[model samples]
Structures are given as structure tokens and as C-alpha cells.
Target: MPLQRDASPRMASMLLTTYRALGAAANPLLRVFHRRRVKSGKEDVSRREERFGRASVARPQGRLAWIHAASVGEANAVLPLVRATIERGFKVVMTTGTLTSAQVVAQIELEGLIHQFVPYDTLPNINRFLDHWQPELAITVESEIWPVMITELERRKVPLIVINGRMSEGSFRNWQRVGGLARSVFGALKMVVAQSDADAERFKRLGVASAVNAGNIKFDGKAPSFDPEAVQELQQRIGQRPVWVAASTHPGEETQVLETHRLLTRAFPTLLTIIVPRHPKRGQLIAEEIAGFGLSVAQRSKGEEITPDTDVYLADTLGELGLFYKLASIVFVGGSLVPIGGHNLLEPAQLHCAIISGGNTTNFAAVYRQFNREGGALKASNPVELAAAVERLLNSPEETEQLAVKAAELVAAGAGALNQTLEALEPFLRQETSRQRTKGEV
Candidate 1:
């Protein structure tokens, strides 16, 4: 028998070829995928064609800047950059992969910006997308190095820059196994303005020569906008009750949150635990799960009103984390407990929520560690520890207030990444402008 082939060598190239072939085969199947997503309220039926690399609207004329952000978090992180690029005289066509991100973009009021769905990364899809937009340059947000897309950008000589570049050690190690493909693909990037020195070093180790630390732009993110009137109304309704939030939680993590609630309720009888699932579509299922825990739950999406007897409130709505953050001083930012690499801690920190996180936060390792060391946030390795953390906050109002203040101070101190990233991109912006001037298109 032939020796079992080692799949490590040339694995990246092999994967890319298989990826494009699968994408080609997925073309017709996309309709079925879209239908299922639409039915589940995950896809926008009106803008489905955009996924096929078909332009929904005519591309704006002259000096177009194409920005791709994978989802809501990345899209939100790049908003300031998008606006700044527009101010610098480029028509930005921003692309996001998910419906929630599309809605997030729709909510923003940027005049020089147009939002579209990112095309599938098949050769035909990529070709069609490039032919129409013909962007002067491409900018992608944190870790969005699509191989096919990068190859196309290089072929067109459209310089690609990845701002706020991030690479986890696990990802770096995986890429290193196929160093040839990593180098060939990363070699095309004009620069990767990374979030931290560790991230920059990881990218450099993977053959990104121009990768440099620029801090994390999320520190500069605006405090999430919330309707004050709505917050006031909710406050009036809830009266004076002990409250906490388990926010941006993924599936398996909610069990831990529920257990924490169960333990906390013994001490604070009227304790209210508000769970904000990462995907709002799971509102009903989560609501049912809460009910199964012998907790009276109300879901915001279903227009269910919170009652005095309600033990849990499911804020299963969009763009409302700010509102929930204001209602509670104690918050457990989720995706940490179940090894999902954690969710953003900056949001809660910005709002002065005394933060609690779990052992895992590889997605935001640098920031999380900083927060933990400075007491800007508390870490709870298990469900029992989670309950203990919340109880600690509940028992000492002064400590809770101090921790919240410390976290907010840390967030403010972590600012300046936005300026650094803008500075890094200034050279490329000038080059694109000069090229346009040469072509008499400026």
C-alpha cells in the first residue's frame, strides 16, 4: 500500500484550489442557502444578488475605495476609517458578510459610503466583482485574508492593506504548517497595521514583512449609541432591583450564565439576569431555555413586557447593548466560558460596567490581560466563580463603582490606535491619489 500521504506540504494551495472549486459548485446551491437563511431571518432577500458578485447599485465614479469587513464587529471597528477615507475624497464601497452587519451599516448615515454584501470568493464571482467596482485600493479589517480575493487584488495591482491586523498563536501555528502558501498570500499585502506587538510578530513570522503594531482601534470606538428615552422608560419599569447582564453570549455559555443566576438568586431574591444572545434569532430558543430553568423570562424581540416577577430579560434585539449596559453596573461579557475566544470587552468597559470574563479570551488576549491585571475587569474561570464575582460586586457597591471607573479609565487610556492606523495608511492614500492624478481621474 502507498504510504499515507502527509497532507501538510502545499496544503494551503491545495485548500485554495478545492475552495474555488467548491465555490463554483456552491453557486447554484447558494439559492438554497439563501432561502434557508432568509426563512431563518438571517439573510436579506432584497440584497441576495450582491453575494453573487452582482452589483446592486452602480459603483460610484472615480477613486473608489473598497473595504471588506467580515461581520458586525469588524464592520463597526472600521467605521471611523471608512468615514475618514471618504473625507479624503474617495468613494467607499464597504462590504460585510452577514445580514446583521448589513443592518448595522444601514443604520449608519455616511454620505460617501455605500454598503454591499461581500461576493463569494469563487474565481467568476471575484472577477465579476472586480470588473464592476475597479477600486483604486482595498482595505480589509482584522484577519480577513481571503486567499482568492488577495490573489485577485494582486493581479489587478490594487494594493491591499489590512488595518488592525490580528493573528492568534493558534492561527499562526496552523499557517506555519503551510509556510509557502502563507508567504505567497501575505506577500501581496501592502501593509498590516497590527493591533499589538504580539500580533505584528505573529504576522511577520508568517511572512508579512510590513506588519507593524498600531494598537487596537476598538479602544477609540465610540460608546455605542442608545436611545435615552427608551433606557429611562426601562429603568422606570424595572424599579429598584438587583440586575446584571450576560451579554453577547454564545450557545453553550448560557448554561453557565443560567447556573450563575440560580446561585445569585438565593442571596438577591429579585435578581434579574438579562441575557443578550449574540445572534438575536435565537431569542425564542433561549427564552425557552430560561423558562426550563424555572425562571420567568421575557423576550424583547417578541414585544414581551418585563414584569416584577420576571427573573430574566432577553434583550434579543439589535443595536441595544448600550441600553442594557446602562441598566446594570455588573456585566459578564460572554463567548469566554465555552472557548469561543470571547466577545468584545471594550463595549462594557466604555459604558463603565464592572466587567467579568472567563479564562479564555484569545480573540482579545492583549486587552483582556491588561484589563484583568489592572482590576479593570474580573476573571471567573468557572460557573461557581462567576456567581462569586457577581456576588462580590453586589455586596460592595463602592468596589463595583470603583471597578467600573477603572475599566472606563483604561478604555480612555487605550485610545490613539485610530490616529496611529490613519498615519500608517497615509502613505498608501497619497500613492492612490497620485496614481489617480496621473490618469487625470482625480
Candidate 2:
């Protein structure tokens, strides 16, 4: 629902009330949508009741801090903060919207962390979630602004912090149209720790008074982990072939990657190209596209083995990007060829892989620019450039190694955001700890 005009103070208040009422009234419709998603394997079938604010696991004792990350990327980006919260001796309740993120969280061996599906933003649902958890503070990562939930949290006086907060140009423009509603949702935030100065300023203009510029928390996230045995086995199977990976690729960009692979194989005849799509569900479509290019495809999701004849290895499964990043010396981070902003660059860089990307990386623009200046990444604005760059890197092994070293150095230099963020959040954390001590709950 669109927010009405904020011409006057009373009108703004009325509009906020109306928006909440409409959201609560749409609960039945949301339920139907959830059912459809469950049928399509998007939502976890057995965990459907969690969407209605029902808890699958009992809440642990003591002060619980709730961290809500919308999806996989957000969930990954906020891991540093989650770890910090746990180390401070607070029980952590991590909530995310996508099943993929839930799976990712499940794989991570973090103690004192509980994963739950974030409930739909209706009044009753919000109340149920709040009552069950009774969390002392709530922190939201990125730009997931849920109105009814914010209102309920506000009413309950739970401290809200938005960390690693990002406000893209498109989102800022959309929120501008609903000035009052934007204020209503953001006003509840005690503080917004932004990824960039631009985002901090934007949040202030939109009604968040306390938007502080902290470096992107992804910089402080743990390096992608891999299984040693699996990596060794895959390395043996590939057998000294020239290997490269194009990771988190979007729809139209796969064609460019496939073409690039075809070109690279000319220089290094036994070259193997791995394409890890952004969405694993699109694996079959991507395999078909690779086949259309007359390339032999081996899909990881289908248990297809990567053989000598396999031109392309499709790492189209969830939670395995680390294995592929380790397998390849040169990595191309995708979502940049087309206008989908861009994906994270630190993962490959942290793994000491030389990085390449297309020019449309408005998201993570600062990180990409810094990496390029540091000789850690190469830019390819078009398909020809992409293919040429990959081929050049493959031929010059020493140069590739130098770039990988620089990339790792850059990643290391960008660390410490986690420490700064923890310092910034210390006040709230201390307050919650004191409250628990006073009540003898800690």
C-alpha cells in the first residue's frame, strides 16, 4: 500500500494508523501467498507455522538480542555482528527470510545462536514474536524496513539498531514518495550504522536522526570456509588445468561468461570454467544455455562429475561457493555485466584469488574502486574485454599470483569494522546486560 501525503502533522499520524490497519487486514492474503511459496519449494514446508509468529524452538534464558537479516547476502554480511553479539555474552536470535540463508546459518558452527523465520508484519504476528522472544534489543541488517513490526517493537520499547545499513538510490527515491510512512518506520530506530557516508546522509534526510557511517561490515566477515578433503579431491580431479570461476552470476551475464570461457580455452586448451549462478534454482536453465553454446556441462546439483571433456562446471548448489573459490586461481564476481548492481568481492579476495568484474558495480562501488587501484581486481566493461582479461590472467601465472596477493592484502587492510561496530553498540549491549543482572536473569 502506498503512503498518503504528509502535508500536516495530524495527516501523517492518520496515514501511519491507516497503513498499520491495512497491513493487519492483509494477513489472510499474506497467508495465501505463503502457501503458494511453500508449494513452489521457496518456503520450508514444515516450518510454515513460523510465518504466523509461532516459535519452532523454545526461547533460551537471559537477555536475547534479535538480529533480522532479510536473505542470504544480508545474513552473510551480518555474521561479524552476530559473532560480536554472542561474544558479549548475550544469547542471539538470528532471523532471516529465505530458506537458503537458513541453510547457510545451519551450516555455520556458532554456539548461542538460534535461527528462526521472521514472521510476517501483522500486529498480532509481531506481538506474538515479541512476546515469545522477549528480546532486549533488536538489530536489523541492511534495508529491510517492516512497518508493523517496527511499530510493535516501538510500543514495547525494545531498542532498535540498524547496522550495516544501506540505502540505495532506488530505495531512497521510493521512500521519498511516502515521506510520513518512511518517518514512521525509521523513526523507531535508535541508531542506524551505515555502510557509507552517502547512506548515512540519506537516512538522516529520511528521518533517522542517528545514522553513523561505519565501514561495510562485509569487510570484517569471516573468510569463506572450505572442506580440506573435498578441495584436495577436486584439485586432483582437475589435474593442473587452467581453472577460473565466475561466481554469483545473474541471468544475462551467463552468456558473456560462457563466451568468455570459450575464448579462454583457445589459449589454454585444457581450461575449465566454473559458473556459480546467483540463484541455484536456475541451474538447469544455465546448463541449457551452456549446452546451446555447444559446451559440455557438468552440473553440481545433479551429481554430474567434472571430467576432462567437461568444458563448464556448474556450481549451482547452495553454500558451496567457498569450494569453487578455492579451486580457482582467478575469480570473476558477477551481477555487474547487467544492471543488477553487484555482488560481494571480498569472498574471493579473502581466499587469495585474483578478481575480475564488469563495470556496472554501483553496489560495492567503493570496494571495487579501491581494489582496482590496489592492483587486486581488473575491470571488464564488455564481453570481449572480459574474455580477453581472463585469458591474459591465465597466460601470465606470475601476474595472477601477484594480483591474488594484492587482493588478500587489501582484504586484510579493510578489516576492523567489526571492532568499531562492536564499540558503537557497546552502550546498548551494556544496558541489556545490566538489566538482566538486576533481574538475576543473566
Best-fitting candidate, measured by TM-score?
1
Across 273-376, the per-residue lDDT of candidate 2 in tens digits comes to 89998878789989999999999999999999889999999999988889988889999999999998788899998898999999988778778989999798
lDDT tens digits, residue span 1-442, model 1: 1112343437666876787789888888887887898998888889888888999999887689999998888888899999889888889999999888888999988888999899887788888999999888899999888888998888888889999998987788777766767776887788899999989988877767798898999999988778889888888878899899999998888888999999998899999899998889888889888989999998999898889999999999988999999888899999899878888899988888999999989888989999999989999988899999999999999999999999999999999999999999998775654446557863
Question: Candidate 2: where is the Cα deviation over 4 Å?
Answer: 1-7, 266-269, 433-442
Q: What stretches of model 1 exceed 4 Å from their correct place?
A: 1-19, 29-32, 433-442
Q: How many clashing residue pairs, candidate 1?
A: 0
Would you estimate the TM-scores of all the predictions? 0.93, 0.89
Taken over the whole model, the C-alpha lDDT of each candidate is 0.88, 0.86
Clashing pairs in 2: none
Q: Clash totals for all models, in order?
A: 0, 0
